[model samples]
Every structure is written in C-alpha cells, then in structure tokens.
Target: MDPGTNVLDLSQLRRSCSSCALSELCLPAGIGNDDLERLDTAVRDKRTLDRGGMLYRDGDPFEALYVVRSGSLKTFVLDDSGDVQILGFHLPGEIIGFDALASNQHVSQAEALERSSICELPYARLQQVTSEVPALHRQLMRVISREVIEEHRHLVMMGRQQAQEQLAIFLKSLADRYQRLQRDSTALTLSMSRYDIANYLGLVVETVSRLFSRLEEMGVLEVNRKSVRICRPDLLAELCRSSGVPASKRRDAG
Candidate 1:
C-alpha cells in the first residue's frame, strides 16, 4: 500500500476488472461493448493512499474523479475553530471527488482511513465520454441523486439525535453499508479513531466512550479496541427509537 509505487496502469486494470464486483457500480450497466471499451481507454491511472494519508486537501485544484477500488476513505471539513467534522465514509466501490464536478475545486478533504486504492478518471475525459454516451450521463445523474439522499440522512442524524441514539444509528448504518458491500456485517471494525467518531457524531470523546460502555452493558454491543460486535441488533434499533427507557435502565439492558 505504498502510495508512491503502487500506482496501477489504467488499461490493464480495466481489462482485468471487466467482471469485477464493482463493474456495475463503477461503469454504467448494460453499456454497449464499444462504449465500455471507450471508457476503459479513457481512464488514466490508479493511485494508492497509505493509511492516514491525505488524498486531497480542501481548496486543492481538482483534477480527476476518483473511484475507490479497495479499503476506505473519510471526507471531512474543518471549522473556523479548526475542529474536524467527518462528512462521510467512502467504502470500496464508492466514488470520491464527484463533488468536484460542479465546483471545479475540492470543497472538502479526503484522507485514507486504511491503505486504499482509487482509480482516477480525468474529468475532461469523463465529460467527453459522457457527452457521447447517454447511458453514462444517466448513471452520473443516479450517482448524484444517491449522494443527495445520503447527505439528507446525515443531516438528520446530526440535527436531531441524542448521543446514544447517534452511536446506535451510526453503528447500524456502518453495518448496513458493509453488508451492501458483501463484507462481514456483524463484526464491525472502525478505521477511524474515537476522536474521529466523536467529531462525526458531534459529541465529545468522553461521551463516545461512555456510550460504548453503555451499549456494552445493555447487551446490544461488545466493543474491544476499535472493533465492535453487534449482539442484539433488533434491541439496539428499538433503543434508538425509544425515549421511554431510563438512561440507567437502558445501560443495564445491554
């Protein structure tokens, strides 16, 4: 996962990945063979980001739309006080840098949560391909729509939820995302640290630690270091939705 030397040749990777699990997610499904070939040719390079490495920083000149090939990335922004707030986590098969399509400048910073690989598709080339391929245009529209929905969900999570509810919902959402990617859903490993989770959830680190202890006591989760095992998914969801349970009682339930 050396960022410098692990760069992949675009053409070879695309040819080897024709039947990859991410094919439908990355390329427009049902595209003509010729168009797929064109796309394969348009892609320029693949780059790796080592753990804790910055992929791009805010205000950086955007060059290409990046597609996550493996591992994970987190996008975040720093407030005036220099506090970082995580905006979203990008998993394998997800697209990063799509927001650059409109602004032409990176609005947020993206960093590797783990050793990660990303395929860089030059923006100019992508625009050219999309202009000729109607299906690709439609697919890009779909991707934008999904981002809108995801942003809305995050907004709600941040604006309305309590500390415990936020932690529950966050873990559940991560599990669901992993499940969608066909990864182990029950055992969740956090790439981000406690401080990152706290910032993302809009809580203090001490509160996050307390919430983890509370959940473990309630029999809903088992946490060790950064790894969590969901023991009672249904009960956890119920707790997230219920306001009747006393905080102490809820802690005991788990």
Candidate 2:
C-alpha cells in the first residue's frame, strides 16, 4: 500500500495484531487469542505519515499510543535556548507516545523520519482492554518499564562516555536492536540526519561527522552517507567496555 494519510481499516488489512510480525515486541505479546482480538479491535485507526510529517506536537492531548508498523520516527523537544533536543528514535515494532502517559499531554514532538505507517491505539479503549486482559496489562507494564530503563541508560551514557565511546555505543546499540527484530545487525540505513544524531548524542554536528570518519578509518564501520555497515561490532563493544560501561547495559546505550 502507498504511504499516505488515509486511515486503514484493520479488518480489511492483511496485517493486524495476530498477523503482525512485530506482535512479540509490541502490546499483542503474551495476549490470548480472544484477548488479542479484543485488543486488536481497540486499535481504531492506522495512519501513514510522509517523511518529516509531524505525528503529534508537544502539548497535544494524550489520546492514543502509536506503534510504528513500518519506517522510523524521532521524538524531540525544544530546549530553553530553542534548540532541538532529540529524545529518541523509534523503529518498526517500537512504540512511541509514552511521553504523554504521565501528564496526559505530550511533552515532545514525534515526526516521521521516513515514510511511515503507524497503528493508533486509543488510550481509553486501551485502558479498558488492558483491564480485562491480565497478560496484556503485564506486557504493557513491561514495555513501560523498559522505556524507563532505556532513558536511564541513555542519561548514563551521555554523562560518562567520551565522544568516540558514545558514538560506538550508539551504533552498537542500534545494531543490537535490529538483531532483536530479526534483521541484519551489521547493516543500517539511518533515517535520522547527522544533525539529529549529534543532538541526541549531546555533540556538535561536526563532532559527529568527524567521529563517523574516525570509525570508518578504524575499520569499525563502513559509512556511506546515511548508510552504515558495522564492520566490527565487537570493536565497538570493546570501546564501550574500555569506557567503563557495563556489558549488560551496552545494548541499550543508544
């Protein structure tokens, strides 16, 4: 299907909660057949966004949670100086909109980094469905917990690691995430620009550009514009370890 704004009817689509490849990583995980059907029904709409399209702005009402069905998105906020501070990048099977859960309004903006398809789960219906499905509720809790852990890990990485170590950990973490999704862990097509990557890593754009070239020189990565092939993830991991980052938290450092 072409990527556009029309809302997709899940009933007519080939992909749904039960049939989705991302079922194990998303809310549908651990749900029973009947509960899955109910949870699927709670997904009221699926929408497409063009690259650079705004999914939701900061302060928008928290009405639904979005699950990336295809493509990627980046969430960010404007700092006091009005500079954009990237919070995270969302890949397929990853959920966004959790930023609104606490305040009932989004604190950051989510924008499509590429043509993307997203499933919208209305929060009210989700709460009702989760109330009835114990397994689903547990899964939701687990997902939220993981989000918290990821944020904490990112904070630690930013504060403790040097520039090269930060970049290495970030690439290594992205590779690991792809591997978890059953994709090639060594290759990646970065949807977010170098500027976004720099902002997320708390570095200047030039620093990020220089670091990529450095990694390429070290034979740890093969960088071709936005495309990157991790030639030595082991070397990347070692960089993180040498920076005193624990092995267990290395995968989530990005």
Candidate 3:
C-alpha cells in the first residue's frame, strides 16, 4: 500500500464475518446471512502495518474505521514541540480512528507497535449498510460508547502521579483486556515499548522500569522485559486504589 493512497488492496481483505474470531467483538449477533455478507462487503480491505509502521498519520483524511484483528497499535499525537504524546495503546479486538469521525480527518497517528493486521471498515459504505441493518448500527454505537468509557477510566487513572498507582492500574487494564480475549490474564506479554508506556503514563522510561521492579518486589507481578505475570491481582488492585489518594488525605482518613 502506498503512503499516498493509504489503502489496502481489495483482494487481500478477509471477506467473512461468520468465521472471523473477532466478529463478536465488533459485529452484531443474530445477524442474518444477508447482513453478514453486507458487513463483509463493507469492510472491503484488511491493512497490514509492520512494527513501527503507521496506519495513518495525523491530518490525513479519515476514510474508515480500523479494527485490530491481530497484534497491537499505539495512537499518539504530536505536541507543539513535536514530542510524541501517546494517547492510547490498542490491543486485538479493539477499534481505532473513531476520534476523527466528526472532522473527517485524523487527529492522531495510529502506528503498529508490532506486526499487525487491521480490518478497515469504509465509513461511507458502513453508514449505508447500517441503515439497512439496525443491529449493526446499534453495535457500532455500543462500541463507540465503550471507547468513551474506557478513555474516561484512563483519564482518571493517569491523574495519579504515584508510580504504584499508575503502573498497577495500567497492568490491571491490560489483564482485563486479555481476559476479554480469553487469553491468559495471569501471564502475558506487553508488545508496546517501554517508551510508549512511559509517554502514555506521563512518566519517564526509567520511572516505568523502576515501577516494574517495585511491583516484582511486592510480589504483585513478575516482569521479564516485555513479558509480565500477575502473581497477585488483588494486591495490585489495592495498591492502585490506595496509592492514588493524597498522602495527607489518607492519613486524615486513617
């Protein structure tokens, strides 16, 4: 795919909803054969992005919604100083590019943090098909709402400056997403870079590493490079909750 067109070739697109593993993540249930076929047609392309490759850059014209079928992506915006401020890291079964739905232009760049495949749903065609398939429209709306809620959760989580609170919540969020995908939540690999994680959490890379060591010392988790094993999720959650409170407030309440 050329950077100019930013389009995937048609023949490479996966054209089946019935057998797709991620169908339940983004597709409506009880869909008839006709509606399923319509969905297959609506998502006319599947794009591939190599690690460090961008799905779309900021200011690009938004043409479609991208659903991650495999691997991970990071969405980031450039500050006035041109520093990257990571907005979010996306996992399998998640959708990106919705932030541009109103403006018809990308507000952030979505890049693959690993080799990834994404199903591209053409927004124009999707609108037409969803009008005929009310369930599909409802599913899209539900997905949008869920994104909003998740973003809100992240906003609150990041408001805390303590490494314990920030990293514990971040780990828990990843575990929850893995559980949703029926993958092992206890043991997992974080494909995103430490730098990206630091940027997203408003911390330095060294701080991120230090927090991981602290978590290991607490026996809450074990970290091996990008690999992580949650040894005590309950304890981790407790730390996330308590560490976020101001020290003076905690003392007064105590």
lDDT of 3: 0.85
- Compute each candidate's TM-score over C-alphas: 0.86, 0.89, 0.89
Candidate 1 vs candidate 3, lDDT winner: 3
Mark the regions of model 2 whose C-alpha exceeds 4 Å error after superposition: 1-10, 13-15, 27-30, 244-254
- Specify the poorest-scoring 10-residue window by lDDT in model 1: 11-20
Q: Model 2: which ten-residue window has the lowest total lDDT?
A: 241-250
RMSD of 2: 7.0
Q: Per-residue lDDT tens digits of candidate 2, residues 157-238?
A: 7885588888877888888889989999999999999999898999999999998998788788899998999887777888
lDDT agreement of model 1 with the native: 0.82
Clashing pairs in 2: none
lDDT of each: 0.82, 0.86, 0.85
Tell me which of candidates 1 and 2 scores higher on TM-score: 2
Q: If ranked by lDDT, best first, what sequence of candidates would result?
A: 2, 3, 1
